[model samples]
Target: MDCREAREKLLLATSDDLPSAEASELRSHLTSCAACRGEEARLADVFGRLATMKRDRMPESVRAGYWEGLSARLREEGLVRSPGGARSVARPARGISARLAGATVAAAVLVGAFLVGWFAGLFTQQEKGTEPPRAVRPDTPPPAPRADEGREREPIESAPATGWTSDFALGNGPADRGEGVYAEFVLGPEAAGENPVEYGIDEALPQDPWVASIDF
Candidate 1:
């Protein structure tokens, strides 16, 4: 026999009303099925404990209306009366209350988890701490120009050779170096081989030979 049938038989056996043939079959099934045997042991344990509990006697006044009130309540709940007026079939609530209770517990758990995660994140950020603001140094002025820095760098000194003597000098005047500089060019009799010819500072020379002005 299956465990379902065997368990029903075990319940009936508690009242000593199980038939001899069914008892024999159940005993045989229990011998082969360890699960059913364990269920039978549990049932026996529960019944043994219940048997030892003190039984309270019902008063006659309460007992008289108890059955009538129970029957009326059962009828109001749409329960079907069974045989012998001692049994009934109640309409199950289909676990509606249990499902609602389970949903409430699930929502509570989700809220608790979210709170825990938020607190954890907050604590982690606090532990890492914020970086201090960097100290900003003030902008510094560049160093002053050196005394020898304003000398003119002449590029004409590295030019191709010309058969002329050129002398360029700056005067010790009120202006800065290269501001009041002067240049003197001594002309030559030949284009290439002749010696340079000198002219007096006060002489008015001819202007037709070569004249070019250069700005420093």
Candidate 2:
């Protein structure tokens, strides 16, 4: 008998319904097949636990529908052989348990793959963390200058000092203003000397239209 036939005969094996010849065949197949042996062991363990559970907890219609559907599948799959009778009776067992075990195995595989990927990511991050940073050399060239940096800046002359000087010294009152386009003069302290130089309006406003020209 194959594993499928042996598993179908499993419940019958526990009961008196299984014929001796079929039992011998099942036993021989179990020795060779690790999967069938595991399933047989699982059934025995599960069936014992199931015995105490209430079977009538579901509504009558629901229970009937479930059993009817399962019965059709078993008959269609030839998982259970019906004896010669007007009505099909005595189905082997629920194959749902075997399907559930397969589903469980698939779930475990997905979880195993997920955990492996997660740990691999962590290991990769740790490897990156352990690596030392590269050092910058002191002689490395600086970043290129900006386009505007090469242009010359406009020169700004410093404002004249507040204090007076010997040459071109500012008078006490805000330097006098004239009606014409007059010159305003101020000198720094560095220009102080005995020979005081006078700064006239013409020297400061030589190009002004109103500047008074002097003739020698």
List residue ranges in candidate 1 displaced over 4 A.
12-24, 31-35, 81-216
**Candidate 1 pairs with clashing backbones:** none
For candidate 1, report its TM-score.
Answer: 0.29
* Cα deviation of 120, candidate 2, in Å: 36
lDDT of 2 by residue, 1-216 (tens): 754456556656654457899888888988987766755674454345333322212123222343344345445545334545432424323332233332221212221122222222323332343322212223312323433333221111232343322111101111122221111222222233322121111122211121112110
Worst 10 residues of 1 by lDDT: 207-216
Regions of model 2 farther than 4 Å from truth: 55-216
Q: What digit string (tens of lDDT, one per residue) describes model 1 on residues 12-84? A: 6654668999999999999987766765675565445333332222233322433344344444544324435
TM-score of 2: 0.26
The pairs that clash in candidate 2 are none
